[model samples]
Target: MIDALPPLREVIETHGLSAKKSLGQNFILDLNLTSRIARIPGDLSGADVLEVGPGPGGLTRGLLAEGARRVVAIEKDPRCLPALAEIAAHYPGRLEVHEGDALEFDPRLLNGPVHIVANLPYNVGTELLVRWLTPKVWPPFWSGLTLMFQREVADRITAQPGGKAYGRLAVLAQWKAEARVALTLPPEAFTPPPKVHSAVVHLTPRPEPQFPADPKMMNRVVAMAFGQRRKMLRASMKAMTPGIEDVLVEAGIKPTERAEQVPIEGFAALSRALTARGL
Candidate 1:
């Protein structure tokens, strides 16, 4: 909390940095708020933190102030580098800034258990989240994710079956991880307010999936079901494996059920049943 470095506004002005709509950037200049966000990932006493799209490094400063052992920040906009560099100089070896696209940047390059927390760019937020959700390994490489998404997307992630927001995203998120809406940020919190409010979601990977099913089969079942969401399972799954109705019965899912009405466990069960039949 005792960062003697220049104020973020001065840093932004000095670097000629302006939030860009094209890059989906919305800078948060408030140090107090940023610090609060940094603490959301729990006690960072000696944790390795991964941050994305750190425009002007407001959250980066917060992270260091809150005691992150090491922070690897990925920034695509070169304009923000000078501001981030200033913070790096102040914090010494605690901060590392990488100039590249976050989507292409790999977290495995850094050592230790990573706690990814960021005010992610709006445009690529959902896609990035999906990539993190479906990592090659179970229990994921990162210990957890504390991410900011448009509130609507957050709703979709934490949404349950039978809710309008429930779909493939909800199924995938809830099945493999324990996710919840941790906080909500009004549009005014950003430099250039977006049309909708933002939400912070915390997802802790489950040691084991809520139910057992092959990843590929589970994803395929989820995609097909939600893709044809409006249709019942018997009708929608017609294009999928044959004998779908029998599997639904075996999985204890109603053949007449629609995608939105199916629970995560049911989908996993149905996927296991389907794959077991060699379908």
Candidate 2:
């Protein structure tokens, strides 16, 4: 046992915390796996970690046991609150449990240099990642992110150009941070195994984007290019501006290239070219 607290299974049973499919809950009862995830972001001794959807507090306990300076857990399910409260009691002031939607909670309330680590709820994982990556500021509030997602989603985040998985997600994530799939977890790792496999992704924010481009324009350009990915850039991005071919030429991207054929740098170039034209 990592602490005097009862085993996770016992705690879940005691609290009547059954995994809720509606909420996208698949509790990780294994302390070892959770601890391993906690350690992925390197030493947490000096970082305040933000955890979302900590069903039954399994990852929350791991975060505390692994010596995170402080852990702020946001749980949407009210039934899991008691289990998390027990963990908070075990660790004293190290853990804070908030019962609310993670999407609604703001991370800016937390102090600087925070590291966000979580086995994010499946339903909200991608949306949350996008939100974190596209904040108004260049450098987001959290210094690093260690997040778990469905294998397919993980592939999209870390995928390179010219692949089916490489699209808006790949462009957005890779443009904003250094992303890679750090670990793969089998379906059986959770209490109720999901149909698909899961993988953990580690991302460290770049002080500034690898290439210069307006974030809003970049998103617009990427979305349009990938919206009709089967079409060449000349056809798909024609609506972006009247002089679409000129924009592609200015950015050094071939008009015949598909969205998947363009790398992050190429997309950023397109965005910059559009901005330069006062679009």
Best by TM-score: 2
- Which one is best on lDDT? 2
lDDT tens per residue, model 1, 31-86: 99999888888987667899999999989999999999999999999998888898
How many residue pairs clash per model? 0, 0
lDDT per residue for candidate 2 within 1-279, as digits (tens), equals 777788899988999998999998888888988988988999989989999999888888888999999999998889988888888888899988888998899887687679999999899999999999999998889899999999999999999998999999999999999999999999999889999999999999999998999999999999999999999999999998888998898899999999999999999999999999999
Residue 55 of model 1, lDDT score: 91
- Candidates in order have lDDT scores of 0.90, 0.92
CA shift of 86, model 1, Å: 0.4
lDDT of 2 at 141: 92
